[model samples]
Target: MYACIAQWIPPLERPRFIAVVLYAIGLGTAVALPMCGMVIDAAGWPAAFYVTGICSLLWCVLWFSIIYSTPAQHPRISREELQYIENAVRSSGTSHNGPTRVPWKSMATSLPFWAITVTEMCNSYGITIIRAQLPTFMKNIFGLSIKMVIT
Candidate 1:
């Protein structure tokens, strides 16, 4: 999605748009997790899953309804804007005929790929562990209630 934004947007504005999108995602995560945790505390873990599943479904609906694959395919894009995207793409010498084939075997076997993947896995695991265990830690260590821990 961010890649789509970066591609359709003007070059000077691309980074800003991508950054805003990333920040929005980060902000949504920050807000949603604690609320989900609270829901778990009140209604048990299954409620959290239900909430997440419903939200995911809604996002799917919105994505399919609103998003187009490219500026050329978008129904509502201005002619000038589409021309601009076409010109930029032409200048970049990158085809919009669909992405070039990726070197999957080479990429999968690459040292840098493995290093980055492992690092990301560890980081995600650490964050998951903290999210799962922190409320208990707060309750036990500081005698905090669920509300206090979540808020």
Candidate 2:
């Protein structure tokens, strides 16, 4: 989904688009973390899970209704916007015949690929630790309730 969005972004705006998408993701996580804690504290852990599940379902529905893999496929887009996107893609020389086959052998030996893999693993580990343990840490170390930690 993100790769599709990246493809649609004009080359000059790609950096800003990626930054904004990442910022939104981080912001959503920040907001949802405390909200989940509060929900768990108030209604119990099951309710928090239910809330999250419902939100996910709603997002899927909205995404299906609103997003297209390409600007040319978007039914609700204005003619001007469609023309702009077509022009941008044409000018960028990024239009493809179809999906290209991956160079599996090259990727397997790539230093940059290994670097990114390791970096992602470390990042996920840190985020998981904080997300899974922060509430307990706050309770034990700071003598704070779940609601208090969230607040």
Model 1: residues with Cα > 4 Å off, grouped in runs: 2-6, 104-118
Among these predictions, the greatest TM-score belongs to 2
lDDT of 1 at 76: 89
Flag regions of model 2 displaced more than 4 Å. Answer: none
- TM per prediction: 0.72, 0.90
Q: What is the C-alpha lDDT of each candidate?
A: 0.80, 0.85
The prediction achieving the highest lDDT against the true structure is: 2
Cα shift from native, residue 81, model 1 (Å): 2.1
Q: Report the lDDT tens digits of candidate 1 across residue range 25-46.
A: 7687777778877988889979
**Model 1 Cα shift for residue 71 (angstroms):** 1.3
Evaluate residue 32 in candidate 2 and report its C-alpha lDDT on the 0 to 100 scale: 86
